[model samples]
Target: MSDPKLQEKIIDALKTVQDPDLHKDIVSLGFVKNLNMEGGNVKFDVELTTPACPVKEQLRTECETKVKAIDGVVQVEVNMTAVVRSTEHAQPILTGVKNIIAVASGKGGVGKSTVSTNLAIALSLTGARVGLMDADIYGPSIPQMMGIPISSPKVGSENKFFPHEKYGLKVVSAAFLTKQGQPLMLRGPMLGGIIQQFLQNVEWGELDYLIIDLPPGTGDVQLTLTQKAPISGAVVVTTPQEISLIDADKGVKMFQ
Candidate 1:
């Protein structure tokens, strides 16, 4: 059903296209998938590491150009897709979530929630399964920022609850659990307990990226979350000022 020599030629041509980030050829990275051939027609999928890859289109174009250059190739079909790589967690919590990203800062007013909201939406726009959690107990603002109505997550059997689905993100927020305009008079211990509860009780199923907007500061909220869950990575936001950077440094150190 296929010509051996022609297949070899196609493979060789594809080897010239290297992934800018990984610095490896598509063939070597095993990005080429579902390759099918019929006489002069060649069709294949270019599976990438992340859906939001910066050079997705460039890689697709390069793949098409190289395949079309093959002598016997009369037609070329290259589809770009992504499968996000995940980090290994010691604990089996959030088993279905592939990546858990934390958005943090040293102090308030640094726009941590703003970054988290946009980052989660941006990843979702790339066609990846994404979730957003507002871990800021004292001042939960993700609901308003995401335009998500304040509502409780759906409770399932056995103390589990499903996160609210909106804007292509499975969202959970502290604001959803309390009355509007009411201050959270929670003590230090309660803060950590809530974080653990959110991590263990909420049902965030099969997400490529679960972005958690951590409350500003290196306090109970931060400690509770980091200890209870495996953070794949963190993005610490801050301003150029010395005061802001000092707190940002502390936030970064907390994750380390």
Candidate 2:
């Protein structure tokens, strides 16, 4: 016979489990799809908001532990599946920009943004029209690194802000929207939305290359850009350190 008491305990324990990115309890967030208990063997399904979730393993482990702590549960099994958010399927708003290239690094502090900014400038200076998109929503250092003051884009009658021009390269970033020295607290879905707006809504006005400075790690932003946009290719940057190389491999596989 099934143990209703044990199942109740399992559900109560799951209340403490939260999605790392959304910062909401998994049960309330509706991630727990279904729970089945057959002869002390428990199985459950977890639906994630993004396919590139970095904490999938962590979540699985947490679920297992919570269920196992129940009195009658002998073993636990979890099946995780990613369901793309509704907004992610919406049509892109920048069709003018071309040749999107994601510049990524296995780890931070590898000068990936430096390479991206200089490359955009160099491409523009060489007479090929260029645009640089600082997609690093968490730590947007492009505006400062490129010496552009943190300022908002001028809203036009059409409700689109013209991109800021620097070194002949059109630039856009979340830093431009935020007040100076303010924190950008954004979740994965929000970050993906911002990137989409930067690409589709911004009036880049014809370009040979649109270089995207992706945040370090293999996460939602990287996955969204490549899947949403017609990404031509990606460039992986890393130091001589072996640890960096391991992360670099993960980054490359994210594209493949």
The number of the candidate with the highest TM-score is: 1
Q: List the residue pairs that clash in candidate 2.
A: 93-200, 94-199, 94-200
lDDT of 2 by residue, 68-178 (tens): 888788999999876544322233534555467789988998889999998787766645677889998889999998889999898776777788988888889889979
Prediction 1 TM-score vs. true: 0.97
Query: Per-residue CA lDDT of candidate 1, range 151-183, in tens?
Result: 667789887988888898989999888777667
lDDT scores of the candidates, listed in order: 0.90, 0.82
Against the true structure, whose lDDT is highest?
Answer: 1
- For candidate 1, the lDDT comes to 0.90
Against the correct fold, how does model 2 do in TM-score? 0.63
Shift in Å, residue 226, candidate 2: 1.1
Q: State the RMSD for candidate 2.
A: 17.2
